[model samples]
Target: MSARWAADLALGVRLALGGGGARTAWARLALTATGVGLGVVVLLSASSLPHMLAARADRSAARLPVAEAAGGVDPVFAAGRDDEFRGRGLQGYLVQPTGPHPPAAPGVDRLPGPGEAVLSPALAALLQSPEGALLRPRFSQRVIGTIGDTGLTGPNELYFYVGAADVAGQPMAQPVRGFGGEPARRGLDPLEVLLVVLGATTCLVPVFVFVVASTRLAAAARDRRLAAVRLVGADRAQVRRIAAGEALLGAFAGLVAGAGLFLLVRVLVPRITVSAFRGGIFAADVVPDWRLGGPVLLALPVLACAAAVFALRKVVIEPLGVVRRGTRVRRKLWWRLLPLAAGGALVIGRLGTEDARDPFVIAGVVLILVAVPVVLPWLVERVAGLLGGGSPAWLLAVRRLQLDSATAARLVSGIAVVLAGSIALQGVYARAEGDRPPPGNVRVLATAFATGVDGARAFTTALHALPGLAGVPVTTHALLQNAAGEKFSLAVQTCAELAVAGCRDGDVYTSDRLAPGAGLWSGGADRTRPPQWTIPVAGHHVTAQEGAALIVTPGALSTAPGLALSVNATIPAAGPDVVEQVRNLIGWHGRVSSLGTERDDTSALITRVLSVGSVLVLLFAAGSLLIAAWEQLRERRSTLAALMANGVGRGVLARSLQWQLAIPVAVAAVVAVLAGLGLDWLLLTLLVHRPMVADPVAIGILTATAAAAVLLVTAVTLPALWRTASLAHLREE
Candidate 1:
């Protein structure tokens, strides 16, 4: 053991300063540092996200105050609290007031007797008051008091606070009452999930960086007079220990750099958001938690060492003479390219057929990711050959990509992943950009109101007369229970009977167990408690028991008892010209909304997210590309030196080097486009199981962008490549 340790230590000391191993060690450290820094950034960000989410959830839950309830209350209420509050819950209150001025808005000067409640900030804002006070209407002395924010009873609503007592007298839950449904109650926040995904992905970087550097260094050591060590009684194990130890040292240095970067990002996120809620810098508090940090710190080094150890085994088993020539994957090119083709097909098909705006974009991203490794080698070879034209230095530099396909693949793989992620995100954003509202939606919403039947007919007449207008009115309605358990109005539009062209379906469906067109009356086993009523909506009916109703058309509702119906028109294909004409014809009598508005909003949000995500991906990709280029240049330095000795000009050599990098990037871009199509197809499949309705224009744009990226990368590397190819000083050295 002592002999082995001494031998390993000596090798380790020599590797730290000897020939190429010394440079390789430093290079490995640099590469690992980048990866570790990314990992740490992702780690801190991801950890804080979940902690922040939980904290926010807890805070919001606390503010509700109903979790404090201890004794028996309504069975439903008790059941709801069971999950959130393990022990005693908050006391629930119901205060009904009989006072003079019923609560109109916030802040009222002394109601008749018991004061009013401060319900929600939204209510306060709506009422144009400060404290949400209500003067009991027609009653001499009675009032309810309350606090906190609650949301109105509706889909996609903001939070508002409402007390049972505050709305006890109202016919329905004060316009917005939801005791059971809230956004908070939904699983985890999506943003938190995104952070986790980022962290998990970044963790693999150090492993790759360490493995590649170690492999290269180990190969070099054999040729540089280190081969006799094993013959001189130094076993493979000792050699491996030395190599792995060097990797460990590099990993530790990287960890420090990574930790510092994580801290910086942590500080930045809060400043960007600027709110009362400060996210955990390390998880749930100001102080760092080892439960999270320990895992990170320990995991990074372990991953690095494990990667090094695995690569070291390859270094050990091989005979020194052959291994000195360098390692290679003895596989056919066709075998590799086949996977690339399959992946490309999937990616291209997806990008071609699906809505770029769908979450399915992520799937397309994955396909592109899978295809990259298969395509990279050939791409590098082709690009390098092209760059090698007429330039000896560039020709030599280009051989690095040609002769060592695996190394090139390794170097380029990171860039491929980065590019895939960015393009997928960008596709999402671009589609969104086309759909963004023209600043008119928000302003128009305030002036517009749902139209009555006659009002709709009148508006439709004017709309049809408008220039560029060509569509019939599409109006639908729904019967839904109000917060106070009273059935009232609900409605939506079905423009052109197409889902995407600005048409939404109301949430009204027949209960499969119940018969169609059956009226719900309070009675039998399932029907005993306000038995639901099923009514015919249009030609095709929805089953809604008496109390539980479904959607209907404005025309259909006209026949229903005590039902006042309204009509709305939708122009799915309408443009600015038609919109303006319709506006003039309608003369401000009814509300006008373009389906485009919603699409535009969705697009804007998608763009923001894609932009941020793409930037990070680009950074990672660029770094990988640079590392690959640098290593390639270094590995083939001798070849370039020979060319310099042969009187090959540095300029030509640089061009060749540029071509090598450029060609592979271009090839990857092409493969990416093909993969993008598969991505589009996958999305289209999700939209409709049958044949796709592909967007040719979108395909064209995607292809163009990918091609452009390849060109851009090539342009950026040309000058530096030329300089590297010029072996004037290298030859002398």
Candidate 2:
């Protein structure tokens, strides 16, 4: 290489290394790099799961079309009556005329004669048939061509085909209206949404943290160089370029490493699921979408450099007549720091105010993390002061903390922030989920109901006559079609009885549509059509059991031929006798369930998960704390020797160290409390239905753990500190 080219390369390497010296700076860089790498791995892996899920859903969905009726049959009923039809023995079907359909019985003309059915792939799986195969749990038909791939229905459902006779089996006998209504649509995939949020958080948050940590490290080093340069007659602009260049180089290298790791992770994720494929011939290979990979790769390095450049902007400018003895806080430039503090506060506020239901809440929280460093310095100073006293070792540690408050704040703040932020979020989630209204008391939903007005009236009267069941409202519902060709069901009960099912009901109950009472009115065109009315069902019914269809009045479905009218009861939490008494009156065939059981099961699962996650996080924190603490301990050898010479006891010295550390953690607890409250507000206002009830026990455990760690670290260090102190006395010989 030419001399000039070699010099340029040398300069680039020097810039990248900054003034921390290549070897030492490299170690810090490596740690930061590791964090970045881990973040990328999590981002690439977890984020990619959703795409895989969607693809799986699509592949599964491919065999099924949106459940629909033949052109000759009313599509309106087909679309609106999926739940009703499914319950009445209609199965899921794929969209293809060539597919097999369910066989008809000897007298059932509406059933497919030989080989036709309409069913989703899920149904097919249950029946052990290929897509578009006829379901003959009772009979048989020849398997025909399968349904063509379409991205309309949910995965792995049964799909069948049938001619005009298919609609005849429907209990409803209303004359078929023209084919028109809401198309069968898939709801947003919760898994996909989770993946997207996880991906975005992993990618963006890690990168942000990596850049912030790296930038802070880089800028600190550069400032030392800049200070030296100012003494040597370098101009501000010249100093700034050198600092900027160094930062840019470090960032570029980190980004390159990060991207390489990111790509490797992306390639490896398909393999995680590959093990599950188990001898399948269809190889599950995802062509890495460069559409995604390319942008991430290109943007990461650029982002790294930009982050470095931004961080260094302040330290590059030299203050006039500034000395390096004390921390430099240029009075003239104090206003600049306000922006940083303000920026952090704004981010925190935004996250706090966000609708927790939105996935963006994750992003906001990650962004708010930047505020950690801004707040950490003040905390460290207070904490370090609390650990005072001069047994040589203790004095040394204190002096060190006092001397480089900036660096201490920068390094330790990340750890503190990780600890605090995690605690705050988890604390809030635990509280909110735990304190949520009991499923029975909060929702007042009926778990089981009988069909038909007569059944509902009799059921209501029977239950009301029983002692202790007077308040129980048996919500009645009807299924019907509107003039618009829309199908609906009503959940009807007296307004006072709405809470009996765990929901608030107006005099006219309707579906939960936001439009003012549209939930109440139904089935009519302009002035000519007859008004269709349906009652609304709420509480446990809406929250849990109303999965397939809306709760409605018995009169609604009565108009449909062969339709069964049922009254469903929202049972509250009570003794077995109370439950059985109601059940005896309704008969054995009535619908029966308790939403509280479902809620309790769900809550138990969440508790287990949170407990597991907290353990893992604590382990990570403890390990990191030990390593960092040990490193600090090693650096205090000279001070320890001095303290030992003065005859300071090892026990006292250990207590001092413990005291200092405890101060910061105590501060962190306060921060956690504030953050927890903020989180509770966010959850109550934006995410959940009730005020959060933080588990005092869980919080106590966490507090105890943190306290125990402080004491344990102190206890553990005493032997070592004593050994070192004793060695110092031996050195005196």
Count of backbone clashes, every candidate in sequence: 70, 73
What would the TM-score be for candidate 2 when compared with the true structure? Answer: 0.49
- By summed lDDT, the worst window of 10 consecutive residues in model 2 runs over 79-88
Error of 1 at 71 (Å): 15
lDDT score, candidate 1: 0.43
Instruction: State the lDDT of candidate 1 residue by residue for 453-537, as single tens digits.
Output: 4444455565556664445544534344422344444453332342333223322334444334544321111223442333454
- Give the runs in model 2 whose Cα sits over 4 Å from its true position: 1-29, 39-207, 215-253, 256-369, 390-396, 415-437, 441-662, 675-733
What is model 1's C-alpha RMSD?
A: 13.2
TM-scores for every candidate against the unseen true structure:
0.52, 0.49
TM-score of 1: 0.52
